[model samples]
Structure formats: structure tokens, C-alpha cells
Target: CLTASSNTDGATVVVEPCTTNNAAQTWVQNGQTLLVFGNKCLDVTNGVTNTNGVKMQIWTCTPGQGDAAQHWSITSTKTIQWAGQTECLDLSGGRLTSGNQIQVWLCENGNANQVWNLV
Candidate 1:
């Protein structure tokens, strides 16, 4: 599921499982640019490279041909691989605590948090 929070304060968010009928789950690929229906692009907050459970936020998908941060490849197994990074959309560590954050990390091949369903 892809969830989006308000950009202003990072509050007021909506969460839903990825389903075939949802437009928000639909991702459009124009060459190297990806566009979500709600104009939300995947972002790793603060441009931190290491995992360590940093927050993931949604921002506008910018125009660029080979920006590594914006590049994503959905594997046949539904895991999302961020462009040029070995880390996948990880949910590891634990349930998303109220103040805790999400991050991309090395694929430990576990199911607790590293597993994600890309729509």
C-alpha cells in the first residue's frame, strides 16, 4: 500500500492497500520520470544515504532522465528497487511507531518489515 501525508505538516495522511482499481497506486513512467496520480513522488527525507530508519516522504516528481533517487524498478516479486541503490522499500525494524520513521535498507530477505507490495 502507498500512503501519502500532507506535505505542509506531515500530518493528515491516508493509507490504503494497493489494489488494481486505485488510481493512486498507478505509476506512470515517462522515460525516467515517474508520476503518481496524486503528484506524490517517492523521497527519502533529508537525502540521507544510509538506512537507520529515516522517514520517507512524498514530493513532486521532478523532471530528469537519470536521477538515481527518482529511478525505481518494480521487480516481478513486487519489491521496489530505488534507482542506483541496493536497498529496497523496507518496512523492517518494527511496526511504524507514531514517532518512528521508515527507510530503505539492505534486503535481509526477511518478512517482518522488508517486504512491500508495490502496486
Candidate 2:
């Protein structure tokens, strides 16, 4: 689960056990965008380039009005990639425990850290 550090803008996106009725874990997939905190979109920190290990955060959705950092797509191979890019969401250090933050890295087939199952 992509859990928000807090239901606010610029919150870190972490992986945690999914909990019922928890807004932090509730993500709405809008087209190619993953929306949380009602209107916030999962964003790449600093609108950085396709650099490995770039962390993710939540920012207010701007849709067609903002950078591509906030746009994502769950690829056919189950990788959550930055829209129109080859980078996928990678679990920092490949750690699955709670509080492990996610980062953007080059997508790789069969990489468990980049594979995500949307529920």
C-alpha cells in the first residue's frame, strides 16, 4: 500500500500494511494518475529528471496544468511507471517493511521492487 505520511501536500509516500478506512492508504487511480488525500497526486519529489533514487511525495493535482512528475501508469507488467517515461516506482532499498519510502528508478522486468499490484 502507498501510505501517506500525513494527509497533506508534500507528504512522503510510504509502503505500509493496508488498513480499512484509512485515508492515507486509500488511493484513487484517476486515468494514469494515482490520487490521494482527495485531490493530491503522487508526485516525484522536486520534479526531478529520470534519475535513479528520486523519492516520491504527494502534491496537489494539476492534471494538464502541471509537470509530468505527478502522472503515472500501471504498466502491463505491473510496474507503476512515471507517465511517458521508463522509470518505475521502486521501493527504497527493496525494503517492504512499514515506513520504507519509495523512489523512482529505471524499470526492470521481474524486479520485485518495481512490481506493484493495484487493488
Candidate 3:
């Protein structure tokens, strides 16, 4: 599950086991973007990924930002695209670790770390 604890900007995109009817976990998809906790769209900090461990977060959506970091797209194969960039959401260390932060990295075909599935 993802969340914005304060339902506001700069809130970390939390990763947890999905629960029922949690307002913070709610997400609405508009085209390729995922809006969460109201006005903030799920985004990457600083609009770039300098390295690994940069966890996902939410920010106010720009009507025409045209920024890749703020946009997203998903493939039928279950890969989430990081806007127009070649990076993708990945599991840290290619495995689950306590306190792991979801990050954006170059997509590796068939890597389990970059795959996601709908519940």
C-alpha cells in the first residue's frame, strides 16, 4: 500500500501490505499519473534518481509539467514506466528488505525487481 501520512505534499510514498479502505492508500489514475491522498501525484524526489534507495513520494501535480519524473505509465506485462524516461520502479537489492525504499532504475527485461502485479 502507498500513502501520504498528512495527505499533503512531500509525504513519502509508503509501501506496506494493502489494507481495506485506507484513505491514505487510495490512488486515482488519470491517464498515466497516479494521484494519491488528494492533490499530490506520486512522484520522485527532485524529479531525478541520482542513485538507489530514493523512495517514492507524492507532490502537487503540475497541469502541464511535462516532466518525466512526475508522470508514469504501465505495461500490460506489469511494468510501471517512469514517464518518458527509461527508468522504472524497482525493489531495492532485487529483494525485499525491512525499510526498503522503492526506487527508479534502468529497466532490466524480465527482472523480478521491476515487475508488479494487481491484487
Looking at model 3, residue 96 earns an lDDT score of: 58
Q: Write the per-residue lDDT of candidate 3 for residues 6-109, one digit (tens) a residue.
A: 56777776456667987777887777787776567878888865555567777888786535667888887788778777788777676554445677878778
Query: How many steric overlaps are in each model, in order?
Result: 2, 0, 0
Model 1 bad stretches (over 4 Å):
7-34, 96-101
Choose 1 or 3, whichever is better by lDDT: 3
Clashing pairs in 3: none
Highest TM-score model number: 2
Per residue, candidate 2 scores C-alpha lDDT tens digits across 1-117 of: 879898778889999988899989888988777888778889999989769998899999885634688888888988998988889999989898999999999998999999888
Each model's Cα RMSD: 4.1, 1.4, 2.5
Residue 62 lDDT in candidate 3: 75
Overall local distance difference test of candidate 2 = 0.87
Give candidate 1's error at residue 72 in angstroms: 1.7
Q: Write the per-residue lDDT of candidate 1 for residues 9-46, one digit (tens) a residue.
A: 23222344445766544656655445555455666665
Candidate 2: stretches off by over 4 Å: 63-66
For each candidate, the alpha-carbon lDDT, in order, equals 0.56, 0.87, 0.72
Better candidate by lDDT, 2 or 3? 2
TM for every model, in the order presented, reads 0.64, 0.93, 0.80
